[model samples]
Target: MVAVVVELLALQVPENGYGSINDAKVLAFGEMGFGIFGSFLVLTLFFKPLVCQQPNTDESFVFEFLQKMGLNPPKDYGFSGSFCSWRGVFCDDKGENVVGLEASGLGLSGVIPDTTIGKLIKLETLDLSSNRITALPSDFWSLGSIKKLNLSHNQITGSLSSNIGNFGRLESLDLSFNNFSGSIPEAVSSLSSLQALNLSHNGFESAIPTGIAQCRSLVAVDLSENSLNGSLPNGFGAALSQLKFLSLAGNEILGRASDFTGMKSIIYLNISGNQFKGSVVEVFEGPLEVIDLSRNQFQGHIAQVNFSSTFKWSNLLYLDLCENELSGEFFTDLIHAQNLKHLNLAYNRFTKQRFLQVDMLTNLEYLNLSGTNLIGEIPSNVSSLVSLRTLDLSENHLSNRIPPVLAKNLKVLDLSCNNLTGDIPLMLIGELHGMESFNFSYNNLSFCASQFSRETLEAAFIGSVNSCPIAANPDFFKRRAPKHRGLEIALVLTISMVCLLVGLLFLAFRCRRETRMWVVKQNSFREEQTISGPFSFQTDSTTWVADVKQATSVPVVIFEKPLLNFTFADLLSATSHFDRGTLLAEGRFGPVYGGLLPGGIHVAVKVLVHGSTMTDQEAARELEYLGRIKHPNLVPLTGYCLAGEQRIAIYDYMENGNLQNLLYDLPLGVQTTEDWSNDTWEDENNGIQNEATLVSWVRGLVRRNQALLAIDPKIRGTGPDAQMIEALKIGYLCTAETPSKRPSMQQVVGLLKDLEQITL
Candidate 1:
C-alpha cells in the first residue's frame, strides 16, 4: 500500500515545473506527499453519500444489541453519520452495499442481532471473534454469500448445522477457541470450497467425521484441543490431496500412525498429544517441511528413511518426537536433514552410544536430546553445527571436555547432570559473546582456579550442582557476615538493646494479647498445640513475594491445616518455580497455573494480581472462608499463601474447567432446528431479554412435546432423551431470574441422582 501511494505521488508531481529543484522545491514535494496520503486514506474509508447509497433497512439493531449487551464502542462508532461509514463495515466496489463486517475484539457480548445482519444479503465476510459473544440468532448462518467467517475466541455454543454446506462458495471457516461442542457436523465436511477449517480449542468430541473426505479443496485443517476420540475415518487422509497443514493434536485419536502415503502435498503435520499406539516408524515419506509426533505412546522404532531417494530431507525444517517411548537407532537419515532448523528427540529411549557427526547438521538452530541416554564422549564434530542457537544435552551420560567451538555462536547451552569430568575449558568460557543462558551443573567437571566470569554465573541453573562456583555448596552456606568497625558495632548494639527494652516495657504495660490453643486430654495427660509463627502480613509492601523468598523457601499458610506440612519449596518443585508453560489462564486477579504436586495431586495455583483492593490479612481470611464452601462443580480452595501484598491461592485443578467455557463459546453461529424449536422467535420483533430467556422458552417448548434443544445432536438417539430433557430442565431452572425461585442444593442433588438412571 505504501508503494502504491508513493507511485501515485510520483505521478502527481510535474517534472521540472520548477526549472531548478532546490530547498523550496523539496519542501513543496514533502507538503504534497502528506496531502496525497490523506486523500488516499479518505478514498479508502467507506462513505455512504459517496455513491448516494443509503442503507435500505434499519441497521440501528446492532447498536441496540450492543447496548443490551452492556457494550459501547468508541464514541466515534455510532449512528451520528451514515451507518455504512461506521467502523468495521465495508462497502462493495460500487459503494452501494455492505460487503464485510469485522467487529471483532471490541468486548461485545450476547447474541448477534439478527435484524442487523439479516438485511446484509451482500455481506461476503464477517468476523466477530475475540469477544464475549454468547449466542447467535436462529438464521445467523443465512448469510450464504459469506466466504470467510471467523467467530473464534468467543463463548458460542451448540452443534454445527448441516445447512452450512449451503455456503458452497465459502473458503475459510475458523471457529477455534470457543465453547462450541459436539462432533464436527457432516455438512461442514462436505464444503468442497473450503480452503482452511479451524475448529481447534473447542469442546468438540467424537471421532473425525468420515464426511471430511468431501472437503477436497481444503489446504489446512485444525481440530486440536478437543475431546475427540476414536480413530480418524478411513479414506480421510487419502482425500485431502491438497492439504498443506493438518493438526489433530491434543485429543484422544486412537489408532496406528495414520497412512499419509497418498498425501503427496503434505507439508506441515502435527498429531501430537493423542492415543496413537504404534511405532513412530509408521510415518511415510513426504515433501513435508515440519512434523510433530510428540507426547504420545508410540514405541519401538522410527522409519529409517532413504532420504536421498524416497524424500527430500532438505525440505524438512522441524521434526519433534519428544515425550514418547520410541527407541532403536537414531537413523543416519538425520544426517541428510542438513536444512533442519529445529529438532527435538528428548524424553525418549534413544540409547545411542554416541551421536557421531551431529555437527553435520550445520543449519540446525535448536537441538534437544536431553533424557535420551546418550552415552560415551560428546560428538567429536559437535562444533560443526555452527548455526546452533540453543542446545540441550542435559540428563545424558556424555563425558568429555567442553567443546570450545560449540560455545562460540550459541545463545543457550545446557549440559547439566552429565558425567563429563575435566577442568573447565578456560578459552571456551571466555569466547561466549552471545551466551544468554549457560548451565554446566551436576557434572563431574572440576572447577578451575580461574573461576567463571560474573556474566556466566548470573545465568540460571537447571539441575542440582556441587562443583560450579555459583552453585550453593557447604562453603556458601557457611559463609559469615563481614565484621563491622568496633565503635560502630558497639553503638548499633546499644541502640538496638534500648529500643528492645522500650518495646518490651510498652507491650507489658499497654497491650493484652490473646493466644488460642487446642488441648487434647487423653489417659490423664494433656497436650497443648498452638501455632506461633512470625507475624507481619501487615505491611503494604509491593515486593513482598521477593522479600519472603529472601527469608524462606515458601510461606505456605494452610487454610484447613492438612497433615502434610507443605512449604514454598513444594510449590516451586510442583510447578518448576511457576514456569510460564504451566500457566492455565490469566484473569483480572492474576494468572492461574496448573501444577502436579507430590503424590500426583494436580492443583491450580492462582497468584493474586498486585495492587488489588484486598489487604494481605483480609485476603487470607476470605480465602479460608472460601475453602469451606465445596461442591461437585465448584473448585475447592485448598490453601493460601500471604506474604506482604502477595497472595497465592491453591485449588484442585478441574479437568474441564468452568461451566461457561464448557457449555458455550462466544458464537458458534449455528442455525439448526436440533438446538431450537421450529417456532423459535429469533426475529428482533419478538421480545428476547437474554440467553436465559431462550433457555426458558426452550424448557416450556420441550414441555409441549416440541423438539428438545440440544447442543450436540450426535448424543441424541445414542442416549436416552428423558435424561437429556431432565438435564435441560435443571439448567433452565438454575438460570431463573429470581434467585430464590431456584432449587436448593439438596433438591438439585436429589434431582441429579434420580436422572442418573437414564444414562446411555
Candidate 2:
C-alpha cells in the first residue's frame, strides 16, 4: 500500500533557519491505463511479460524470519526485495544463500522465533546484540554448523543447555551482558576449537568449570564480575597455554601464585579483585605485555626482580600494583621493562626513595606514584620523560615547585595535596598551552588569580588547586574582553600600516601581479565577498569550512583586548588541533568546541557550518550583526574567525552549556485540555500522596487539574509550575504566527510581572 507519511520534523525556528518547504521537488508522473479494447489487442499481440522476484529456495527461511521480527516495513514490512538486500543480511559468494545476519544495537526487542531461524541451517553468523531479547528459540540450537553466534548485551536469561555442544564448530560464542545465570555449562568444554569465551558481567555462580581446560584452542577468556569462587582447577593454567588475554577480576576465585603456571603466550592478564594470595615470584610467564594485580591480597614486599630485571619482560607495556598490601622499594633502574608505558603503584606502602631514574622508562607515557611515600627534592632529571602524557604524584610528601620541564607534552598533571611551595610558575603555565587537566589543590602554592585565565581554571577539575593570591583579587575575573570596536580600530590601523609599508616596498622595483593581488588580500577583510562552498586559504580569509580537516590558517579577531593574543594556531593547538574530544556540542549551524586560550582562558568556539545556501559574506554579516547585540544575560561574542568556508564565533564560555540545550531539555509540546492525565499527583514529600492502596481504588482516582507547562524535571511539579505556565503564555504570544496575535515587549513584560506577583 502506498501511503503518505505526514511527519512534521522541522520545528518552528527563526525565519533564516526554518527550511523552506515551498522548494519541494517538482515530480511529474505518467501512467498508462489499458482500455477494454486495448487489453483485447494486447492479449492477441503478446503474452504477458514475466515479472517476479528471482527465485531462491534458501532465501525463504530468512525472509520468513524477518517477517516474524516485524522489522520489514517498520509496521508492515515484508520481504519485498531480494532476501539478500534486507538490512544486516549478507549472502554468500554466489549470492544465493544468506550466510550472515546481524541486527544488534538496532533496538530490536522481544524473543526470537524458532521455526524460521531453524530453517536457515546455512547461516554461518548470527548477531542480535544490544537488544531487549529475553530468550532464544528452542530450535535455534539446530544451527549446528554456525561458526560464530553473538547475543550479547541483551536481556537474554536462562541457563545455556548442554545442547551448546551442537555447535561443535563454534570458534567464538559471546553471550555476555545478559541476565544469563547458573553454573558454566560442561558442554562448553566440548568445543575444542573455541578461541574466545566471554562470560563476564553476568550472574554466573560456582567455580570455573574444570572441564573448560578441554578447550585447548581458547586464546581469550574473560570470566570477571561473576560469583565464581573456590580455587581454579590445578591444570587450568597449564591447559591455556595459547591464551593471550585472561581476565578473572571482580570475582571470588581464590588461588595461590604457585597454582598458576605455564601460560607463556598470555599477553594481557588481570587477576585483580580476587582472593589470589601468595608471592608474585615467578608468577607471569615471559613476554607478558600487561599485568594488573591491583586490589588483591598479595602481601609482602615484591621480589622486584621479577618485574624489573633487564631482559625479563621484553614486551611488558603496562604494570599496575596499586591498592595492595605489598611494600617495597621500586627498582631504581626499571630498564627491564623497556617497553612499559603505563605504571601505577598508588595507595601502597612503598618506602621513600630517590625515584629520579629518568633514563629507566624513556617510553613511559603514564606514571602514577601517589601515596607511595617518595620524598626529597623533585627529580631534576624527571623532565626526561619525553613521551610522558600523564603524571600523578598527588597525596605524597614530595616537597617542591613543579618541575618546569616535567611533562612538557603532558595533557594531565596531578600534583594536588602535596607539600609544594612557592609562587605558581607563570612560564610553566604559559608553556603548557596544550595542557587539558592540571591539579595543584591542597598545596602551599600561591599565585595571582588573573594569571590563570578562565580556560585554565576550567581545565582544572573542581577543587583541583588550593589557594592562589590572585583569586582573592577583586579584579581577578574583571579582565578585559576585547570589544568589537577594538577590532575595528585594529583593522583600520593594520590597513594604514600595510598601505604605508607597501608604498615603500613598491618604490623599490617593478611589482609583480602577485604583489598587487597580495595588497587586495590585505584589504579583503573589509570586503564582504559572498564566497560559497568549501574553500581554503592561509594567514587570513573571510570564510573557512567548518569541517576543518587540516589546521586552519585563518586570523582570529578579538572583540576586545583579551587576556592573551591567541591566534587560530594557538586555539587549534589548545584543542589538539580541533580533535573530536574537544567537541562540546553540535548545533544546527555547526559544532562547538572547548579550547584553552593562552593564560588558561576557557572559551567556547562555535564554528558555523557553511551550506550551499549561505555564503562567506552572509555568514560574516550574520555573525557581526548578532555580535552587536549586547545584553546583561547574553553570552558575549568574544571574537570571530574566518578562513575559506570556515566561519567561527568565539564566545565567553558558559560552563552550564548553552541555552539551546536547555530549551531542548524541556521538550515543549502542545497539551490540549482533553488529553490531560487523570491520576493522583505525587509530591516529593515521603507521605503516601495517593489515598488508596487498592488497585481498584487507585484506578478510579483522578489527578488534580493543572496546566501542562513544560519545564526541566529539576523544577517540574514544584512551585514554578504556575510561573512556567504564565511565562509560556507570554512566549507563545510573542511567537504567534499571525502579526496581530503577537504581543509587544512592553505588554509581555507587564504580563510577566503580573505572573510573578501572582505566584509570590
Candidate 3:
C-alpha cells in the first residue's frame, strides 16, 4: 500500500508540468498524502464500530442477561462501565468484550439465552454454578476461546455433545451434580488442552470411557457418585501421568488396588463405597494426602500392607479404611503418619490386637475404632493427644478401667457397649469439664463422681444390678450397718445406751461444742442483718419441706438463711405437693418444677434424684455461687432444699422458655402427619414472646401472613432499634451449640451492649 501511494505521488509530480520538477514533486506529493489520509479515515469510520462496538451498550446487554438469569449486580456496576467493575464479571482494560462470567448461586432458572451469549466471542471463562438452569445450548460451544467452564449443581441434563471436543483452549471442565447421562463421547479425547475434569454426581453409565485416558494433559478427574461400571480402562493410569485427585467413590467399578499403579502423582484417591475388592496394599504408594477405601471387602491383615515402608503417606491427613476385613495390629504403621488428623478403622475384626496406640499422633483429633473387637483397657498414653477431641472405642471388648487422663481435652467420648468396670474415676470427671457427650452405657461402671452423679449417671445406669456404694470401701458399709439382727434386742440396746449416756462425759462435751457454734452463728447473723437492714425472706420453710417429701422417699430440710434449717414437709407444700403439672424444665441435672411459697413468692425448684457420688456440700456451693451473681439475662438461684439423698436448688421462674425451643421450632414445609399430631402444637407455638422469637417469627410471619404485624409491643415506638435487636440476637446464637459454645455471662452482656447501638 505504501509503494502504491509513492507511485501515485510520482505520477502527480509529472502531471504538474513545472520547470523545476523537484518543487512540483513536493506540492503533488503533499496533495497525494492528504488524499491517502482521507481514504484511511473513511475506512476506519466504517469498520471500527462494526468490529469493536461501544463498550457501554455491550455491557448493558451483559447486565440484562445477568438480571434475566436472576443475578443482582453489585451496586454502581454496569456495562459501558469497566467489565472488571461488574460483580462476577471480569474483562480487559478496553472493556469492549466480555472475558469472564462467574455467576453462582443466583437462583437462575431456565436455559441460558443464545443471543447474548453468542455475542461474547471474546469470553475466556464461564461459571454458572448452583443455579436452576437446565441444559447448555449447542451454541455455547461456539466460544472456542473459553478456557474454563463450570456448570455444577444445576439441573443441566443431556450428554455432552461431541462439539465440546472442538474447544482447543479449554483447560478445566466441571459438569458435576447434573443429570448428564450416557457414555462420555470418545471425541472428548481430542481436548488436548483439558487439565481438570469433574463429571461427579452425574448419571454417567456404561464402562469407564477409554477415551478419557487419551487426554494426556488431564491432572484431576472426579467421576464419583456415578454408575460407571466395568474395570477401569487398561493403561488408564499410564495415559494420564499428571492426575492428582481421582475419586470414583459410590460407583460400581470392580478392580484391585493394582489397577491404580501408574498414577504416581495421585494424592487424593477415594475408591470407597464401591465393590472394589482385594488387598488395599496394591494402591499403597505415592505421597498420598487423603485415602478413603472404606466400605469395601478388602481382606487380609493390615500388617501385610507394609504401608510405612512403601507409601510415605506423611502428608496424609485423612485415612478411612473402615468396614473392611483388614485385620492385624492397629496403629502399628500409624506412627509414621504423624500428620494424620482423622483416622477411622471402625467395624474391622482387630481381635488379637487388644490395644491400639495413638500417642505418636499428637495432631490426631478424630479417632474411630468402634466395633473393632478391641480388648484390654484404653492405654493411659492417650493423654499425649492434647489435640484430640473425639474418641470412639464403642462396641469393643475393652474391659477394666477407662483411662482418667484420656478424658482431658476430649469433647466426645463413646465407651458404650464395652466391658469397662470399677468406679468411674474422680480424675476423669475433673478432666471432662469441657465434655459434651459421655456415653458409658452397657459398661460395668459402678458410679460417676461429680455433680453429674445424681442425674446423668444415675439415669444412665438405672437397671444395673451392681450396687454403687457411696464410700470407697466395703468396710465403711459394715461399720454403718446395725450390729444386731433382732428388733427387740436392738430397741433394748438403744434404750440402754441413751440411759447410760444421759449423764455421761461424752454428752457434756457434745453440748459444749454445739452451744459454741450456735452462739457464733447467731452473732454472725445479727451482724449481717444490721449491715443490710431488714430484708424479707420470700420463700416459706414449711413449703420446702412438704415438697421435698413428695418428690423423694427420704426426709429433707429447708434452710431459711444459709445457716438455719427446717424439716422435709416444707418442700412438698411449696411445689404444690410435688404435682407433675408444676414441672418447669428437665435437663441433664434433673427436673425443675414451679413452686409457690406461703409468703406468696414463686420459685423454680430443681430436684435431683439420688444415686450419684456427688456430695450435698458440693451442690450447695454451686448453687450459692449461682445465687450471689446477678445478671438481667441470667436466671437467678435463690436457695437449696436438701433431703437424705435427694438434692434440690431453687431459682426464679422464667416465664419464657429457653432459646432452644425458639430457634429449633419447625419451619415452613416440614411434613405433618397424624403420628406427630401431639408434637405439632409444641413445635409451632415455641415461645414467640422474646426478641429472638420475635425476629425469627417476623421472618416466618412475613411469609405466612405476607406482611409485618404491629411492631412487637416489647419494643413498640422504640423505632425498631435494629442494633439492639441484633445484639440480643447473639444470646440466641450462643445457645445454638453445646453449653461450651454458649458464651460466658460476661461476653453475653458485652455483646448485647454493642448491638444495642446499631442503627436500623
Candidate 4:
C-alpha cells in the first residue's frame, strides 16, 4: 500500500523545479503523512466492501468534476475502469478513491460549477495551473484533505475568499500570475501548516498583513512585482528562521536592512527596485548564493561590509549593488568571495584609484564597473581570468592603450567613452568575428586599414578613427614645427590662390570648346538634310486612315493628355505610315519609333509582341495596370492601343536618350583620366587591360585589401572613408563569381541603405 501511494505522489508532482530545496523537503514530509493516512483508511474500508458490487463514491465525484469543468475523460477507460487509468489522475491503493489530479496547462476555461470538485473529500493534491480558468466555485474551500493547491498562471479574478483558512492541512499554495486583487485576507494566518506561498505578479495592494508572522512554517515567499506598500511587519524576518528564498523586489516597500537579520537559512534574497534605505552590511549574514540590492537607497563603504557567507567555500555566486550610494575600495573587500561569478557595481561613486586589483578574482564571469569614476590603465593581469565572458568599463577616465591579451572566452566587451588611445591590436580584430558585442567607440583609439574590414567591424565601434596614422608613417612624430611660422603661412596662402586661379581658367576653356563642338555637329546635320532634299510624308488619300479605323475601333487612352482623343489613324499619320526612318531603337519587344502628335507633343511608341498566348483583352488589361505606375525615375506611360495582333504603348519622350547612351556616349575629344571608372591593370598575357569590367576589377582590389583604391577621386574628400569602404564591400558581395553566392537585389538595397545610415 505504501509503495502504491508513493508511486501516485511521484506521478502527480511537477517535473519542473519550482521551489527551493528547503521548500521541497518540507512539502515532501507533509505529503508523506497524507499518504500514510490514506493507506490506513483504504485498509480499514477494504474488508467491508468485498461482498457488495456497488458503484464507487469517489469515482462518481471525479466524473461529476470532469463533466462540470468540461474536461474530457480518456477514451479507452471512459467510466469502464478505475479513474486512476485516466491521464493526470491518481487513486489510492484500493483504486476506489481519487486523491490527486494534475490538470495544468490543459487550456481549460470557464467558471467551475459548485459541488463538482468540492465533493472529492479524499483529494489531497490539485494542480490546475496554466489554464484559462476565470473563477472557482464557492464550495472549493471545503476540500479539507487538500495538502497542495496550485492555480497559478490563470485569469482567476476576485479577492481570495476568507474561507481559504478552512484548508487547515494545506502545505503549499501558489496563486501567482493571476488577476487577483484587493488586500490579502487576514484569515491566511490560520494555515499553520503552510510552508510555501507565491502571491507574486498580481494586483495585491496595501501593507502586508502583520498576522503572517504567526505561520512559522513558511519557507519561501515571493511577493514581488506587486503594488504592496508600507514597511515590513514587526519581527517579520526574525520569526521566519526557516525561510530559504524571500523576494520583495519591484514593490513599494520601505524598511531598514536590519529587519531581515534573523533569516539564518536564507540562500537567495532580492529586495531591489524598492525605497529601502540603510547600510547593506547587516543583510549579508546568511548562507546566501544570490544577493540583489540594486536600485535602492542603500549607502555604505565596501571596506566595512563583510563579504563572507556562512559556508566555508563562500556560496555567493551573484552580487549586484549597482545604482546605490555605496563607496570605498570596490575590489578590496571582494577578494574573500572567491566563488563569485557575477558582480555589478556600476553607477556608484567609488573613490578613484590609480590601479584596479581585480586579478585575484579569477572565477569572475561577468563584471560591470561603468560610471564609477576610476582613472587608470586596465591591468594587464585581467587576461588571466579565463572564465570572463562579459566586461564593461565604459564612461571612465582610464587612459593608455588596451591590454594586448584579453581572455579569448570573452563574448561581450565594452570600453567606450574613455580616454584609451593607440592602434587596436590585430589579435583583437581577429577575435571580433565571434563576439556577440564589442564597443570601442568614443575613444581615442584608431583602427588599421590593413587589418580591419568594414564587413567584420560591427557598428558598435562606429565612432573610432578609421586610419592608424601613427602606425602607417614612421616619421609622424619626428616632424617639428617650422621656426619661421609666419613666413611659411604666407607662402602656402600665395601658392593656394595661384592654383585656384589656374583651375578656374582651365574649366572655362573646356566649357568653350564643348559649346563649339555642339554648334559644328548641328551645322553638319542641317547640311545632310539639305543634300537628301526636304523630308515629307505622302498623304495622297484618306482611305488608308479609314481602313485603320475599321481594323481597330478602340481609341488610344492617354494619361497626361486625356483630351487628345488619339486613334490608330492619328498614330500612323504621326509615324509617317510606319516608315523605317522613324525607328529609334529595336529591342526584344518589337521596335520603338519617334512621333510628333498634332499638338506638337513628342512621344515614343513601343510595339509589344507576346505571341498568341495572350489575348487582346488580357493584353489591354495588363497595359492598363502598367500605365498606372508612376515614379520620378521611370518614364510615364502616356497612352496605349490594341490593334489586332500588336499592343502599342506610348510614353513621354526623353530628350537625353536612354540610360546606356547617356552614360557611355561621352562628348568627342574628352579623355577618361583619373576617375574611379577608369580602372586598369596589367595582365601577364595582355599588357594593360582597360576593357576589364568594373565589377571584376573591384573584386580583385577587395581581395588584395586595397578597396580604398576604387573610391572615386571626386567623392574621396566629400564623404567619410568608412562609408566608402562599406559601399565597396557591398559591391564585392553583389558581384561574386558564383551566381548562387551573389546577393539578391532586395539584399543589395538593404546593404545600400545601411551605407547611407553610416554616412548620416
Worst ten in a row by lDDT for model 1 = 527-536
* Count of residue pairs whose backbone atoms collide, per candidate: 10, 26, 23, 0
Candidate 4 global lDDT? 0.72
lDDT of each: 0.67, 0.65, 0.66, 0.72
Worst 10 residues of 2 by lDDT: 527-536
Output the number of the lDDT-best candidate: 4
**Per-residue lDDT value at 232 in model 3:** 84
Q: What is the lDDT of residue 498 in candidate 4?
A: 100
Candidate 2, residue 63: Cα displacement in angstroms equals 2.1
lDDT tens readout by residue for model 1, 1-760: 5556545534543331111111112224465577665655554343222222223443444444555555543334442355567777777777656788787887878877666665567888988889998887767667778899999999988877677887777999999998888878888765779999999999998988888888899999999999999987787668888898999899999877655546778899899999777765546467889989998888876645333254678788999989888887687778878889999999887766576457568888999988788888776477777788888998788887765456357888888768787766656556544577677766656653224444344232222232545443445556445674677789999999999999999766532221111111112111110010011011112234445554343456556656566776677677766665576654446557788877787889887765246854356547866886756767889888664456789987888665534333222346554433235336566554333465656644433344355435778776788788767666655554434335556556656776887665
Task: State TM-scores per candidate.
Answer: 0.57, 0.54, 0.53, 0.54
Model 3: residues >4 Å from true position, as ranges?
Answer: 1-61, 71-84, 307-310, 431-433, 449-760
- What TM-score number comes out for model 3? 0.53
Candidate 3 structure quality by residue, lDDT tens digits, 1-760: 5456455444533231211222222334465677666654454444332233233354655655665665544332333233456678787678666788877887788887765665677888989899899866657778888999999999988887888887888999999999998877788877898999999999998888788888889889899998888888888877777888889999888888878887878899899987778888767788788899998888887775565355885788999999887776674677878899999999876655667767678899999988888878889888888888899997788898866667367888888777888776667766555787776766767654434544565434432334445564454456533555577677989999988987587778855543332110011121111111111111223333443434443323233353333334556777666664565544445556787755566777876643134555455445544665656777777677556455777777766665434443334456555324223233435554433444444433332332225245677546754554443345333433223224445555555555555665
Ranking by lDDT: 4, 1, 3, 2
Please, what are the lDDT tens digits per residue for candidate 2 over residues 75-113? 233234455666678889888777888877766677777
- Window of ten residues with lowest summed lDDT in model 4: 518-527
Tens digit per residue, CA lDDT, model 4, 176-247: 999998888888889999999999999998888887888899999999888889988899889899999999
Better of 1 and 3 by TM-score: 1
Clashing pairs in 4: none
Q: Higher-lDDT candidate among 2 and 3?
A: 3
